[model samples]
Target: MSFEVGQKVAGKVTGITHFGAFVSLPDNKTGLIHISEISDSYIKDINTVLTVGQEVEVKVLTIAADGKISLSLRQANEQAKPETTGRPKPAFNKENDRNYNKQPQSDQAPRFNKSSAAPSRSSYTPNQNNSPKKEGDFDSLMSGFLKDSEDRLSSLRRNTEGKRGGRGGRRS
Candidate 1:
């Protein structure tokens, strides 16, 4: 018998593999229940969840052109869950509101407040040099670096210049 998508059917577990479990359906057709669809929670081992000859109810997910069926055990259980109420929830009253419409104190800057478990920026000072940096200091810092670099390069060139000609002093 042909099964429609979303159809829940009763079957028996015929085989189990690392990837999935095969269920023998009504028409002697076997469908594969992927490892991910086995349970809501993670299942490290399919053997722990299912065994050979175990009865199971599965929801039909898709039917391939080559007569392959994709089934879901989780979706089958989901179908049996009772729906939530259609009635609307009551509106919240200002008095009953948790915050009570009170504005946060200016002192308590929640945006800057991080979890106590983590190190706060205010507590963790990145200034390892113990120097106070200002916005106008970038140009001065860059110029100082350039001067230092030029001095090093000039000294390197002077030291290497005498060694360039030969391994030993040339014969006259």
Candidate 2:
């Protein structure tokens, strides 16, 4: 009934809660399998994956000073699987391969120039050369942000005024 960290043990899932599942261990002690420790992928609901009285192999993650046990189903499953060597093959893309070997256009320079002074905030103009400006460019970005803010404020004001029936206080 002695349990050490990283030891794989089988247990019966006795109960399940929103946060975790309670597993009855060999020593009559129960350990908790946290929602995060249940799987490598996202789990919206634990009941979808586990049910009462179901047998599961869990790795002993930790034993707190107070004797609380933390277990991981994911780690136990991983330990049971054999390890593979070498990196996974990169996905092939014809366009990416062509672009990777191509040289940059001679007319185009690096995006930033160390010699040139930074443009002043006031002097900045967007879409000057008819080329599409990046969304992060200052002028267009500020204008879009201001417009969105104004729209939200106006919506809030209209909703409040409608609720109040255009009056400031209750009529006597």
Candidate 3:
């Protein structure tokens, strides 16, 4: 039988890998059951849940242009559960909505107040002890650096001049 999207069908688990499981559908076609679709919780090992030749009900999700099929077991279960009931009730439960809207705030640990958080190292804080050097200290540092730079330039100029004189001012 041909498989359609949102249709629950049975397939045999042909192979299981770390990434996902390959299943052979009734129509002799193959589809993949991704590791994430295997269960609702974290799945560290795919082998524990599925094995070769195991029969599984899967819902076809999509068929790619390359002929690859995507299937989901959880969606099949969810869809099947609702169809069993005669009258379709609202999917949403009022109790869940009431709890969601009127839930009391627990006295848990206070959350980090990012709006009133302390300034990071990259941000400027005028009163911070580790702030930039004072104006006088900055001026003194710049003066020392300028003197050292001037000395280096003077030594470089003297060396070039001495070389020029020793070589008769300019090369022939």
Candidate 4:
């Protein structure tokens, strides 16, 4: 039998594979219904949807020069459904008046209050003693850091000076 693209033909499922199912067509011809073409929904397994020797209606999608045929069960099923008029007419709101000529009340750009737009610093107050309390708090933190730095420098200088004096002679 001569097979053409878009022709719906009934065939028996001969083999099921991970990728697709092979359907044996009339005249000893065979076609593959890819896992995707098997159904409109996601198919995790082809065995769940098709079985060997099961009959299925498939639409011929393509015929390769090598005599390979590609078929789609979904396309055949889609052809069975009646076509709709596209979309239903949208329902209109009767109460709302369509104002085509009314200009916006104010043409000037809308004014926004600056204070409410962003968070204020006064809203947050840290409770911990280590946390800075006010603007001058940073100065106290800097003074403490400076004192600690000076103490560390003095201790390092004393240690290095003693080590240098004890080991005055160069290694022989």
Best by TM-score: 2
At residue 55, give the lDDT of candidate 1: 99
> Across residues 1-172, which tens digit of lDDT does each residue of candidate 3 receive?
7667878779999999899999999767999999999888899999999999999999999988888899998787776675564777769877867676775467765588788998887775333254565566777868866866787788888789767776446555
* lDDT preference between candidates 3 and 4, better one: 4
Rank the candidate models, highest TM-score first.
2, 1, 4, 3
TM-score of each: 0.53, 0.56, 0.48, 0.51
A best-first ranking of the candidates according to their lDDT comes to: 2, 1, 4, 3
lDDT of each: 0.87, 0.88, 0.82, 0.86
> After superposition, which runs of candidate 2 have C-alpha atoms over 4 Å from their true positions?
84-87, 90-97, 104-172
Give me the runs in candidate 3 sitting further than 4 Å from their true place. 82-172
What local lDDT does model 4 show for residue 132?
Answer: 62
List residue ranges in candidate 4 displaced over 4 A. 84-172
Q: Please give the lDDT score at residue 3 for candidate 1.
A: 98
Question: What is the number of backbone collisions in each predicted candidate, taken in the order shown?
Answer: 0, 0, 0, 0
Write model 2 residue lDDT over 1-172, tens digit each, in one string.
7999989999999999999999999979999999999999999999999999999999999999999999999999998889888799989887779787788798998786757967777665443344555557788788866876787788888778856867563454
Clashing pairs in 4: none
Model 2 pairs in collision: none
